[model samples]
Target: MLPLSYAIRNLLRSKSRLAQTVGGSALVVLLVMAAVAINQGMSRVLSASGSPNNVILLGTGSEESVQRSEVSENTTGIASASIPGIQEILGVRAVSGEIHFMNYISSDDGSRAQALIRGVSPAILHVHPEVRLTQGRFPAAGEVMVGRLAWRNLGLKQDRLKIGTSITLNDQTLRVVGRFAAPGTVMESEIWAAIGDIRVVAQRETISCVVIRLEDPEDFSEVDLFAKQRLDLELSALRESDYYGRLSEFFSPLRAMIWITVSLIALGAVFGGIHTLYAAFASRVREMGTLQAIGFGRTTLLLSLLQESTLACLTGTLLASTLAMLLLDGLTVPFSIGTFSIEINSTVALIGILSGLLLGIIGVIPPAIRCLKPALPTALRS
Candidate 1:
């Protein structure tokens, strides 16, 4: 069999063609890897936000978003009291009543986009411990706190979302008094306000949902059952983790759509890659014949060709993975997916690399088979 160096030299012999094939293949691989990574990252962010020790109370049929649920203040209080095994800290149960809304905002240029607005209380800080007041203080009644992703992505600076900055929400001006950060969850894309104040401003007499922390994670089912048994409250409870899991299910169709679309595109790229390999091999018919003319057998020629394709593909894979890491690492994109945050972790890189190599192997098979089929004389004539 020819040394691997021989295959390397052969690729270098046609530098332009090698560059084109590798570059094109790498671009395709990079896009696919990025989409997959984003999907995985979003799933991770959603999963991480859920805690088995916490239970979420929402109106029935409101599985994904608390905003869709409307539970009266009295109902929230009763449900909070009814849930067994709830932990009380500093005389207050580890529960937070919240409200949610979205509004369109304009930058200096008047470019507008939707921004998430959540109404939270002091308990928000406890319920979502991952949240931190990075550059400002916690919001008080009638004061709003913007998240880091919102600030970063929308260019809503501390001054823009800080104390005394007025933002129009539902035609009512509200003050921005604080800015917070929740590293990877959907919460990072939101601006928070005092729940009671938001309710007053939005004319909402009821809260969206209530989040409760339990004394023990194992008590979640019991608390859920307790809430369920109290039908007068018209409330249901789920572990915070399970709540987010169900929310993640809401985005599964979108994820599936991306996967299906990418799979079809990958199929086309694979065919293109096969065609390129076939052409590359066809050009080297005489070289294969020369090897066959010598002691080298058809199997050696086939193996060598496969090795070349594999090497090319592996190189493309490495290139794609490296680019994704460098470019998409820690990118905070707003997805409709649960807690939409894209994280390009090591797993994503590995999958990207493996996908490239697999595509390469599949692409080279037909071309490699052609070499084994043609006799030495026929290859020489071609």
Candidate 2:
């Protein structure tokens, strides 16, 4: 058996090859970690955005997208009275009629970007308990409240969305009165204003949806029955969680594209690493033959080679993990619906480490076997 020092020394024999192996592995592992982070971040935000105890009443044909749904403004009042199992705080029922509008908003500096805007009343707080004001207070008649992460979606800086600042929406200027946060949810990337203000700006007589919070999740059937009985309202009842879950499914193709892109890139890097390892081992054939003639088994030589390759790949894994933590962790990324923060938690890190180990093992076998295949006498002649 070769000493551990033998594998270590062989790795340093060619600094260029060592660097190539390490760099290749690092790039592949980093890509995998990034893909995992993106998919996890998007999924986490969507799932957390909805509450099981809540139901969304959308216009019958627009159940898939709240922004596209339009219900009569009077439905909010009617549902509040008709829904029997609804939660109540004091005399007020936990129901909110909201308007969701997505359009270009302009900063004070004249830069415009698309943002998800929500129009709500104070009753929204009762329905969505997760939202809390982090700075200033909720919006008044002509003012707006920005989410702590809304700046990212607007392509602006933090200072741009600060309280007292102003933004242009639908050619109407509105003051920024506060910042709110709904942690781990897409709501953190939205802009909120008074329902009347948005209704005027969006030029719609109807609201997007009416969200109601039930005392118990099991009471959903009662609400569903109401929607079914009221044929004139043209309403559809859906659990809030199920709504967001369907959104996740709707984005399946985008996630699949991400995985496909990462897989293709990683495959190329793996082949390149294998070729480099094979060439490096091919040049060391005579040395392996000499060791074989000295009573060292071919299996031992193969194991030593694997040890060297694994060491380099594992080092790259460490490098990739560090880079991902520094660059990707907690980074906010915006999409059509909202923004999510990439978090390289323990699970993502573990997957990255395992990917590195696989690269080490899979990348070495073919090259290692071929180099150690020749008989001791024939190999020495070469």
lDDT of 2 by residue, 121-167 (tens): 99999999999999999898889999989999878988888999899
Mind giving the per-residue lDDT tens digits that candidate 1 earns over 236-315? 88788888898788778988988888888888888887887787788888778888888898878777777777788778
User: Relative to the unseen true structure, what is the C-alpha lDDT of residue 80 in candidate 2, on a scale of 0 to 100?
Assistant: 97
Index of the highest-TM-score prediction: 2
Please list the Cα RMSD from the true structure of every candidate, rounded to 1 decimal place. Answer: 2.3, 1.2
lDDT of 1: 0.76
Shift of residue 313 alpha carbon in model 1, Å: 1.7
Worst 10 residues of 1 by lDDT: 334-343
Alpha-carbon shift of residue 114 in model 2 (angstroms) = 0.8
Candidate lDDT scores, in order, read 0.76, 0.93
